[model samples]
Target: MTTAFITHHDCGLHNMGPEHPESPIRLLAIQKVLQKTGLIEQLKQMESVHVTPEQIQLAHANLHQKRLEMKQPDEGVVYADEDTALCPDSLHAASLAAGSSILATNQVLSDKVDNAFCAVRPPGHHAEHNAAMGFCFYNNVAIGAMHALQQPNVNRVAVVDFDVHHCNGTVDIFKDKPEVLVCSTFQHPYYPERYCDIQRDNIVNCPIEAHTRASVFREQLEKYWLPAIQNHKPDIIFISAGFDAHHEDPMADLNLTEEDYRWATQLLMDAARTTCGGRIVSVLEGGYNPVSLAFSVQAHLEVMAGY
Candidate 1:
């Protein structure tokens, strides 16, 4: 399927603290597992380029980049919100994270790759249009979707987020834009609870309760998300792929295993093949437990890589 694996070493430089769950070790673990399983050799690996300020503005406020720049710490970490933090290299890594999505979109749309997986982080689903929170800075998937809308022959796009937390930032940016379909399955009454209840034809929000089982999650997606995607008929599909919903994850309560992730990826792949020529640009969001996260990502990639 020619799956592109996009990432940057500098993404590991944006460390908040050793105790922080969103540590660089997350990517390291994924890489180790991919290598150990010989799966890394099956994909097209590429380094991420930096996102331009103008491209960052595609889904952010004009002053957003400047404000983050002003707040960048010289040495110690600075808190952007109660949970999100910025170190000296945080923005640098964030720019790459956002940039990787852009590159992935380009690769998929150009037919150079059937799909791409962005493994960069300071995950962006909770970043919002103007504010940064939930360990996210710039909304990576949003920027990529916006970029795709500007491309030739790309009339519409769908963003499907399966994160434990709602994609408030992605919904915030595309809520009013009908051409962009935003679908999400998240735990109800969760963190950064904004735009979850906002009624929009383009947004299909399936808010599952905490401790939701795997079968139920799949049932919800089949009932809610499938109809929306079929109706939207997007030119491309973007996944805010978060594995934090895994049962072993310390972040949230959901009984999803790596097999669930594989099943979900396969479902999305089928949808993309039907509606978008199998063009998907998936960006990493939240997945805290290194072991579980790595295995989950492996399953997702295996499906995308046609393994």
Candidate 2:
């Protein structure tokens, strides 16, 4: 199996503050770990390209990109929402973040790579179709899924999010579109609580309580997500891979170790082997603690790299 690692140096430029959990150090940590373990040399590393405005509109409102451009501060950071902020280089990095997903989709669909992992900042699962929040802007995975749907021989797609928080933005964009199947396992009564309870055949939401154990998380996915993916029979699979659910993470309460991440990645990989010919494009979402996040990502990539 061949895996592609897609990232951009500029993704580190969108710094909110030194105290902010979503600092550039997150990417630096992942890179450092990958290099230390010799995993970086095993994958096809590529720089991310900028996404066009037309592609950004695939999952966003027509004015969404323009509004963000308009709000960009010249000299200092400006808050788009209570949690999301924008500095001079924020949009530039965001454009690359969104673009990395598009490039990964293309690489996977073209059979150039069996799967791809996008390491990007300003994670996008919380960014709604009309708003940006939760340290996210421009719903990156959504843009990639939309792009994949437009490609030849691609009839349907599935998005699996294992983040501690629900993928409100991804659900918001594809809730009405039956061709896209979204399955998520998140902590109940969490942040950005929108579309969490909306009933849709395409959206399968498994809301686990805080402090949920890894075994229970696996059980929930096997019961809720596995069946959905089998029924959907997607042409491609996209993962909103978030490591914030790790037990060591300061962001949320979940007792998942790197081994759990490895187990989940293998579960999805097994599903992909049968359903989509092992085509998966995973985008980075929320993982705050640099040490735990790096190790967790290493586990996920190890499986993708055929270890």
Candidate 3:
């Protein structure tokens, strides 16, 4: 079974600004590193499609999509909030980013692919049903998870997020849904600090602290994530994979490294193999620091490609 590499040039056009950590250069850096390191030879590369507004509405709201459609600027940049922004081409890139995951999910569910990675960005874990924040316009992972459940008769779906910042949008959108299970590990008392007390049973929030090392991250995976995944027995697995927790990233205080992402990928793949028909779809969420993001993404994709 081949692993799919889904991405597009449009993703690089959704630039936030020169100083923003979530810059368009982040995608360029990863693709360049992948090609330079010859990791592209190990996976099947495919072009991504633009997602429909209805599909975006599946994980978001009518007004949210409507507002985005109305607010799309035709010039330099359109600011949505403090962090998130919309370039003239941002809507195009964001559409393709979300669509890449949906296509990847279909490939995995149809048995055409074993696993897949989406190397597009302007990370989406922070976009909720009615709002866009944290440099995210649409909840890309949530759309992918919803696609998995709605298409191909997947009764249970699981989403795992390991961003240094909490995936508050993902949890908020999925907490009420019984068919979906969300497990997130983010820096406690970090950015977007609403998830201190989880209100749902299926939503597993592992809030770690500043300067946390790999051992602590892995321990939570064993104690919290693995147990919840074992009990849920998801039919398909989706990952909101974020590499900003790397020790080299300046965005947050976590001390994780590329090896930690590789290790977590192995564990998630193992769990997926056991109960989820070995189906996994991963979408990029957060990872700053171009060099560390490139290496960390390469490490994660190597594991996804069975390296």
Give the residue spans of candidate 1 off by over 4 A: none
Error of 2 at 70 (Å): 0.9
Error of 3 at 20 (Å): 1.4
Give stretches of model 2 more than 4 Å off. none
Give the per-residue lDDT digits (tens) of candidate 2, residues 1-307: 8999999999999999888899999999999999999999999999999999999999999999999999999978999998899999999999999999999999999999999999998799998898998999899999999999999999999999999999999999999999999999898888878889999999999888888777999998899999999999999999999999999999888889999999999999999999999999999999999999999999999999899
Tell me the whole-model lDDT of each prediction, alpha carbons only: 0.95, 0.95, 0.89
Tens digits of per-residue lDDT for model 1, 151-266: 99999999999999999999999999999999999988888789989999999999889887789999988999998999999999999999999999998988999999999999
**What are the root-mean-square deviations of the candidates from the true structure over C-alphas?**
0.6, 0.6, 1.0
lDDT of 3 by residue, 1-307 (tens): 5899999987888877798788888888999999999999889999888888888988998889779868888887888998888888888889999999889988898889899999987789999889998899999999988877787668999999998888989988888998899999988888988665787889998988898777999999999999899899999999998999999998899989899999999999999999987899999999889999999999999999987
What TM-score would you give candidate 1 relative to the actual structure? Answer: 0.99
Q: In terms of TM-score, how similar is model 2 to the real structure? A: 0.99
TM-score of each: 0.99, 0.99, 0.98
**Each prediction's number of clashing residue pairs:** 0, 0, 0
